[model samples]
Target: MGDFKVLRLVTQGELSWEVETRYQQCYQLTRKTCKKIKDRVTVFQAPGGFLFDIFEIAEVKHWPDTDVSEFTSITEYVDKTLSGYFFDQELKSALKEKADFFTFGVDVFDVNNDKCFSHVELVATYDTKLGKVSCWTGKSYPTEDQKRDFINCPSLETHCQRLNGIRVLVLGCHDLNMFSPRSRASIAPGTSKEIVINQMQKLCDQFKPQVVLQHPHATDSANIWNAGWAGVRKFLPEVKTYSSAIHYFNTFGGEPRQPLTTVLNRTATRDVQNIVFTCFEDGGIDLV
Candidate 1:
């Protein structure tokens, strides 16, 4: 909890099985990321679609790395990753038997401050209904025709976490974009746009977090899809909003977006920080 440095995995266009036959991707990727990361991640930020379609990796599961200065914690998934359409029975069965699953994620606020996982408090992101995209077919479909992809949120919430004595703001891709009416209709139909934006303001004003992380798979993730964090900047003018996204030209298909890694600063201008990683390289970035 002393150093504020963090290692980010941009998780380029290699979301699916790089092996092409066996889905041995996440662990291999994590191991490679571990090699380059020179900082411990008591609290981490996972880019959207890091492994599965969309998930938040708030804290690393294994800690007590041999050297905190060169944090080398790696991850492996072991649960049934996916059980829905777009996946056949054979593929699902193979994944459940051989692949690993993330077992350490809860909501950011649900973590126990009194408890520590190997001398480090664990912070997790509780997937809530606040800004969850519904039955995403990548396009609209009739309500009845749509299947129940997921349902029944324990609660609706937007939150930031306190980790290693640092106030960190974690925004899902749609969470920040909730300011738009169209986003409301798709992401959280029952809510209003103004309420969404105001909630972010409340968190920023109350916590005065120095760092922010937003992960998405969109092309313009560096600019937050062209709608920058302008609405909330006045309150958090000094905060550095960092972001990581899948590389442009991923299998999802998109044009090249440079400065693939960037941070949105006080004045709401993007401070282009192009950080790149090949399958063999190892390095890290400081949060300070």
Candidate 2:
């Protein structure tokens, strides 16, 4: 489920969550300033209905603010309080299916020190509560540069067997973009694939890790959707790619709310309707 954050609630006054569909349309159009939340969710009630607790996904603050503090109806409030749990349950199911086949691991390291790799270790050991990912190995590292590079990038050399490993070296936002200039902006045609290719090769040479993952930011990806994933494909042709792959718990301040594509892939086409309807019943944002 998306993370839910409590926005302003009517303390002295009573505001029902119920509102007309037209009012909902108005809210949707005006939530731009209020959408900068973590869970990145919006709440809306069914047409000609009421909401109980008004719940807004933490990300709604990213949207343009239009006096969301003002309460319109009571049902909207109820919808906020109750719908979050419902959407959370549904989102859990959806993310589980999305992450099932990715088989990813993390290894974090302190950028300043050679001792603790926080990101890599966290990814490798942290278990997904939704059961989408397998259990963590809880592996520890003694050295700053741990090597195991042949998993994603194949190596024919006898010393480098293709082991299933996720080794990573954290680079700052500036350094990553230095390798791929296109990565500095939105991924587009003729982006410098070589920059990333070179970086991967250099990392492989230095660490000899089975696979290497990078943490690219919107600045590195030009704030484009899935820019990192796209950069992976464009830059590293030798590695395997997964369609509809999503970042694991990475924070992107309020990217547009894309419908759960991974869930739609596993479930039937008709199920999409149910999923979407459930999204609303679960966490659709509407103004009273």
Candidate 3:
């Protein structure tokens, strides 16, 4: 019922898989990008400008990895390795420091069994009105995923929250097609009548979220993720769907990589909802 703008920072660079890199990503986002975030907010000040609703970072942007998991799940990785700073308390403080809204994802690992770990991408969203951090893990891993270790959470669970009087539905990477039969292919092989939950349609029909977001850390071509969005429209036709993602510096096609803002509809350039997709080179991943 409310109209809002989202400012997405799409960073382009060679990302590090070392677990410690996530902290640096956090610093770049919170400190270096602080001024741009604030100035961009003022430029989009309500009344005359698009009242920016969310400041989005590419999926796993502040986290280590390039659509790959170098570490294990929330508990195994963050609990033992990073310790006190793992929750990334700084990211939370940025909700109050940088902008009224901010979000980003981290790559984590999960035990597929006892042997190797499956990749689990985690996304965290913070809103001024909400006043707390909300985290959600990717619910699906497509059969097309080249990675051998993938855990498709078959529970039909997804993240749906209310921010600034607007209901927001968040999707991480392949969760864009969580209910697709193919998405469940490798996971639930011999199923009873193929348990299809129609999770998205159900959410749209029941919860009626106004906005849906897709956060992907893509190292592949734009066509790769665009194909997902093409499939995503059917399930989320009733609301506005935005994919805030990251790509390698040399990523192909023309998918906004330079720092610029665009309207949600992609028809015009606003200012803040006006998405500004910025990039950071190898070690200079910081926005500043």
Question: What RMSD does each model have against the real structure?
Answer: 15.3, 18.8, 9.3
Name the weakest run of 10 consecutive residues (lDDT summed) in model 2: 4-13
Native-referenced Cα lDDT, model 3: 0.43
Which residue pairs in candidate 1 have backbone atoms (N, alpha carbon, C) closer than 3 angstroms, thus clashing? 36-282, 36-283, 77-100, 77-101, 78-100, 78-101, 79-101, 106-125, 106-126, 107-126
**Cα lDDT tens digits for candidate 1, 1-288:** 134443344444433422221233444444444444443343333344443321222243322112222111211111223222223444333323322211111111112323421211111231112111111111011122112221111111223555445776655444445333344345444333344355556656777876655444434334544444543443466565444333333344564445443422221224322223332112222211
Positional deviation of 16 in candidate 2, in angstroms?
27
Please identify model 3 stretches exceeding 4 Å from their true place.
1-3, 38-83, 86-93, 110-115, 127-132, 146-148, 153-157, 178-197, 248-282, 286-288
Ten-residue segment with the worst summed lDDT in candidate 3? Answer: 46-55
The TM-score ranking, best first, is 3, 1, 2
Q: Write the per-residue lDDT of candidate 3 for residues 1-288, one digit (tens) a residue.
A: 224655555445444443455455544544455556643331111110000011112222121122323222332343333334533555445545646555556555432323444444555554533444444334344435434444333333446766566766666656655534344354454442133334445656677765666666653345444444554455555566354444334335565443322213331123234323233433345442
> Taking the tens digit of each residue's C-alpha lDDT, what string does model 2 give over 1-288?
112111111011121223333234223322321232223221110111111111232222111121223212222433343334323454444333322211222222223333322222211111124333222221111111332210111111211222224322222122223234354454344533333345444654655442222222112122333444444445544433122112211134443333344322421112111112111322343332
Error of 2 at 23 (Å): 40
Q: Measure candidate 3: CA RMSD.
A: 9.3
* Best model number under TM-score: 3
